[model samples]
Target: MGESVLLTSTPPEHKESVIVSSAPQSRPWDVHRLPSAEGRNFLVTGGNAGIGYFTAEQLAATGALVVIGSRNPAKADAALASIRSRVPGARVRHLHLDLADLSTLKSAVDGLALDLGRLDAVVHNAGGALDDPPRRETEDGHELMFGTNHLGHYALTRWLAPLLSAAPAGRVVTVGSFAARSERLDLDDLQSTRDYRPKRTYGRSKLAQMCFGFELDRRLRAAGSTVLSAVAHPGGALDSLTPPRPPVGAPTPGERLRGLPAALMVQGKDAGAWPVVRAVLDSDVQGGQLWGPRVFGLRGQPRREPVPAHMADPAVAARLWAASAELTGTTDPHLGFR
Candidate 1:
């Protein structure tokens, strides 16, 4: 591991504009009490299930208009209904998004722009994993995990950039994984064409996503853009530990009992959403920083952690950024920063 960058203090010039929370930072951030985001708009990818659903719900509870981006219309409806049931008068909607297919993204984003006009933040929370495989590829010819996890979000961010930049303070929160801690990217083989193992490939893809997030921050700062990019991870969120949402998730009581023992080491998906939520709403959170669970990095309140050495390498990040640009056809000058 290498030395991680540490820039915890907000720059004097950005102190006023970047602050999102009205609550004082005299104490630890309270997850249950986020600042009102009444007029702001947020888009959460894969907000139909897992951590994404909870993330969207938390943001909706803040009074922001939250859009759940999902490939499945039925699932999106279920998620929207769940949020509405929990948060009365919650402003929420859905955007049909299929990250596996690159061709459809522009239209999806165009629809988003037409509906909301401007976007404050986008949580890159959607991801896919293959338990066992002969091998898999995305519709666009990239490996499934790499395509859907990193490149797909990469393209979405590119298209959403203008809308994000339009806001007073825009943020792109890429949800990374603890699994990436031990993984190193073989940039030449980002799609795992030469060597593809389910676990390793998945980890490498997430690592690529993290690099993109950090690299995006560097580019945004260099351009003097207020659009911030931050990376976060859910420690060890298990389905059994998560509270049931009708039509979305309902682990049996026995499953909950069995998962209770795991609580000492892990947490529910709802709890895991804490760090990502904090990354989006915490005014003090700065770009290029990593946020994760505070307790042994497995379960607890959200707190800023040093970017892992591998994850903080600017050289690797730059290389990955270039590859992503070429792969996604985002080489145009105005795709991301402007």
Candidate 2:
């Protein structure tokens, strides 16, 4: 369920570059040293579980007022409880946010608008490869992975720009996937119209996510907006992004043995959460810093790494930005247009 490779996103020289040059195989982000996220307010989409959950928990532990934007209130509540028990006095709240449904997502703005106050950051951490199996559309009638992964966040962030811009030093980090290396933009099949293959669409959608995120940074900076747009790839933060699950069942002993490859390639969600934490909270971190694992990223410790070649392509990024604005009906006033 994969697509053919595109041009390698990594350049020849910096194929496996690390951002913190001296760091080795275990450069985990130290939550204790995280600066005063106190008094700041932030949001983490899909912040109910996995990387999203851990990110919210860690930030809140540092006393940041965090809102976990989850599609499910129940899951959000559970995540908050988990955080509070470990980090006493952690200030975290939950609200409804489904990346699949735009209207449902926007409703929260009016109901629980942060517009009254400045926002410190936002982590666009929700995404999936739902393009697997029978081609399906979200409730909004768009490709599942592309719509939820890219468009949903596109619209949400556009609306939140004012709050973000008003913050003292705002950061918006979009969570991208490593599959992006193999994905290229397909203008003709932006919605997977001509042909629908799950894995191909998933990778392409992720690639689109990175493009949109970086372009967003370019736009914000050109306009001289204080907002910093940093993009992060979870490397091999694996989960069920693309396909439908084939009912929960038992795995054979030998089938279980086959799980080792992904183990080598992927780390637990807790360990994988550091890159986003580093991107958001580390003061020395600069704008547009790319963070992930130093060792193959997918299944190792966290570090700042190079942006993939395709993800950094300007022309492709620009076209995707325009296309995103059209699809989401957001001019992105914060976008810097030269």
Candidate 3:
């Protein structure tokens, strides 16, 4: 239930940047044209609100059975109710999950396995831009942001890979960030134990996610698994930019000031969810492709875009894959010796 901190501080120049409307606009592939998902199932992390909630709501509105993962059951319940209120007959459920704590994943996965008869996609959308002090570690002993944003999802994906493979058109969609484009990778110290700055660490984690998403696609294809993998970024989408709904909690003053850049530079979450929904539902999109907004590197319709230079390195990706496996204890044996 903890919110992600803003990835960047507001620049003085952003004060003069133009403010735009938050309404959803026409796009090539948009929520309005989303295909029916009546028989399909999906799981979205951090789905209680923001982009994740909208993603789940859009899918469930079109008849997909959605399972939202959140650490707070009350918030999840509120989200589910909100969905049903907006889209009558939406088939939605919530499961408690804390991405910063790995010990809780087993029970979550077990519960999901029982609930899901078939899964069409899993969206790794749970992550924060919160800037905790340097070297803060999760219950699992990894740096908090990296562990929650990348490692926990890594473990969750590995655990759920089989069920996804069984579905006729399974996909794994991991959310990246525009920060990946401007940031450099520190493969040697991915945990950021050596030195930790919030934005840099967040960018590194997103870069790692981009690498993992593409590499997993290659591995799945090489192993002949039916599931597909794709990555997407939300550009500058922020909760503040989205049209206000029922209030959950008030934003801190820092959060308010930080969101000013977004008010000028970013699109709202409704449009931001496009690329993610596209990655999950677009039959034409290929595995390993990246999607994001079309303009200002901040907002617009979804389009295929290049992966970050660091993320595109095959050797780096392989190393990251092995390291993730070691970190999550998901070796080939754990993956059915694939």
Candidate 4:
């Protein structure tokens, strides 16, 4: 997965040769000294808890107008309040969003457009994982994990395309997962109707998401859109290692002590937010690249890694795009690439 290669064929509209630069930076990306994001606007889905919460907090500290999208109003308020407490004068708000219901997406996007007017980047960070179940489905009749994790973001991206394109350098950062690394997609049965294991099904959903991000890059490049799509994953981020954020996450003293030994292998959710933060703020990051932690693909600082073979397949990506468009009813001819 550490090898780098272009994942799509050139668009017929453009005959010019495209040269993709290497992901290595001349100087290490310093997470502490992030460039200012003043005047820019960002949206983080599922920003009320876990890695998304930390991602919102870190971005808010950069002076960006960050909006936290969540289904729970109380938790959203709590997350915003927590960020303001940590970073005085932080500007953050909440947008009602339920990825499980596709019908509501139009209104959600409308509200976002009315409030923000313009958006610079969107972090598809919110995701659902079912550890055990008789198998569940969304309001849209799709598998809960696949629908919420992939199709939800797929439709959201389509709705946000205009706002993203209007920005000087719009960006779409898909927060994928390390779990996706070991999984392969079953395109014929994406919802796992035939074979459903909680963990495996969850992994397949994420794998679909990563493929969408890469495929998006190809389409964006072909359409000559300025919006860039990049994929990133937070390595092994654990709750016990995560620093306490009142009302959001507050690990007990015993929990912290128990997690001490695991620190060697995993990291806090705050640290897990690094690769995502980098993908959003790092000026050098290019489209269609995969980024992850530096150590054992588990924990450490963020670095660019080669896209996994399964996640990088152009054929698989294209097919998934078609399936997603059909499932989500986002069949506008110019929805994504425009």
Candidate 5:
């Protein structure tokens, strides 16, 4: 999180150069008009607030049974309350799901399978900045950023794959970030044992998440798995979902000044939810396709393409696939064996 220290003191002209130029637009006219899950089940991580909150609320308003997965069940209920307060009778239930801890992932997945009877989609959206120094690592010893942001979801997806594949036209949607350009994969130090810089580590983790989505698509096709895999990025929408995570220490004057412009351009989490919605629900969207915003990289209507650089480097992606399977220990014993 303090990787800002790695950057030179020289201030960049803009905090976020990618700016949305066009007004928000939906897809090719009802092209993604999914059945709204009327009898289907959907699992959304970090569903207590912000984009997750709004998207789940919107889906529940449409009659879907949304299983809200969050680390904090209390906060999840509050998020559900906020939605119900708005829609009068939203259908969102709460379950504890801490993405940083893989152990919790299995229990939550099992509970969902038993409680919901079926799961149509699993929205892998729980993530945030590790504001503290980069010293902390997961109990599993993976670097904190890569572990929580990427590996946790990776393992969760692996654990839930069976249910996802069983669902009719199951979709596993993973969230990506615009900052992935900073992702420089250092396979030698995948766990940050040799190096650790917060922003770089975060970007690497996001890139790994994107890579996982694409590679999973290939693997699914190879296995003839019916699940569809797609990736989406919120781009850079900072709404109530972005809790006021104050710095460990007071910020320098330059830091405050550098962040002022971004404070203005950032839209609400609701505005950021569209691209992900398109990715998860769009019928025309193909596997391995990355959906983002058309304007400013991501602030307007969702599109069917990815910004350059993010989709580059297939080699790193393949390495990431092998590393993730090795690290998580969740891969099927029958498949993925050389």
Candidate 6:
């Protein structure tokens, strides 16, 4: 959805204003060049489909033990089979997780405890906006989009922070969005009880996620912890890029029409997952920095993007963090300043 603007060349005056600078010499990260992830463990939320599935598959192919947190057993089994076929002997398992239901999400860690030796990375990518569904609240009573996208991941990361800290280089890579660039954080009405719109609410949720991700990194650094937190966005990638569904019913004639906008301006899921993968494994990437498609925020390569002015505000971040903790009833003692 953020592909409306395209930057072909950089002018001297606009250099600082641009979120992504075109690096003349540096090449974008190619998945083929990835180092082995052997002995590392990664948990990917929403691993059943779309960008999350591709990210998990890429990790599994690189010899990482991937724990995919998904809500549906059927979709999880299908994704597992796809991974196995593509990456022979791929070590991967699935855990049931419903982002709308906090209790179900909490079970993800406990369910995988026996198999999880050390948490190397956690990829929070499980969130979607319903298409014109009735106004809904999560099981936790928060707005559906905000609760599922922000609060759920907030709790999950806090619960697993200790495990992440124990690893040599742990990371929490949250999948944010390019849509967020158009929205502002509305901390006063987080649940949207006063005024609500689906697309805008989705964008607000993404903004909250970005703020939390950067703020978490700041707190971790202050606490002298090695665990790093960063945010990544899949610019303009759409569901139409995924593999076609098996013909079970009448063919939907206008399906491609709905995706035409994204098709023209976006890359496939394979390329969309690059930023998240880079954030998870790239040693050069540090905490608090954001990664996104370098080519006009639509498609090309992952680049360290500049944080938005609002998101960079420490006061806003602190307020959001405090509110999130209060909403989710989660607190990380390790993050406390000594």
lDDT of 5: 0.67
Per-candidate TM-score against the hidden true structure: 0.92, 0.81, 0.85, 0.91, 0.80, 0.85
- Tell me, by TM-score, which candidate is best: 1
Q: What lDDT does each candidate get?
A: 0.87, 0.72, 0.77, 0.86, 0.67, 0.78
Ranking by TM-score: 1, 4, 3, 6, 2, 5
lDDT of 5 by residue, 88-203 (tens): 34567888888778777888888877876657888887776665564677868778878987899888887687778778788888888888856667778877777777777778
Off by more than 4 A, model 1: 1-27
Q: What's the CA error at residue 211 for candidate 5, in Å?
A: 0.8
Candidate 3 Cα misplacement greater than 4 A, ranges: 1-28, 132-134, 248-264, 333-338
Q: Model 1: which residue pairs collide?
A: none
Candidate ordering by lDDT (highest first): 1, 4, 6, 3, 2, 5
What digit string (tens of lDDT, one per residue) describes model 2 on residues 1-338?
01221212424443221122212325445533444555778899988877787678667755678888887777787788766655556678886888888777667755556434767899999876563488888888889889999999888887677678778888889888778887789976789988888999998887788888887887778788888888887666544321111121234556545655677667555556768887887766767668887777775656778777878888887778788788777675464222
lDDT of 4 at 34: 60
Weakest 10 consecutive residues of candidate 1 by summed lDDT: 1-10
In candidate 5, which residue pairs get closer than 3 Å at backbone N, Cα or C atoms, i.e. clash? 19-296
- Residue pairs of candidate 3 with colliding backbone atoms: 4-128, 4-129, 4-130, 5-129, 5-130
Which residue pairs collide in model 4, if any?
A: none
Per-residue error at 44 for model 5, in Å?
0.8
For candidate 3, the lDDT comes to: 0.77
Off by over 4 Å in 4: 1-27
Error of 2 at 7 (Å): 46
For model 6, the stretches where C-alpha displacement exceeds 4 angstroms are 1-28, 243-264, 333-338
The residue-by-residue lDDT of candidate 1 on 34-127, one tens digit each, is 6767788999999999999999988877778899999999999999998777665678999999999999999999999988889999999999
Using lDDT as the measure, the top candidate is: 1
lDDT of 2: 0.72
Q: Residue 151 in candidate 6 has what lDDT?
A: 92
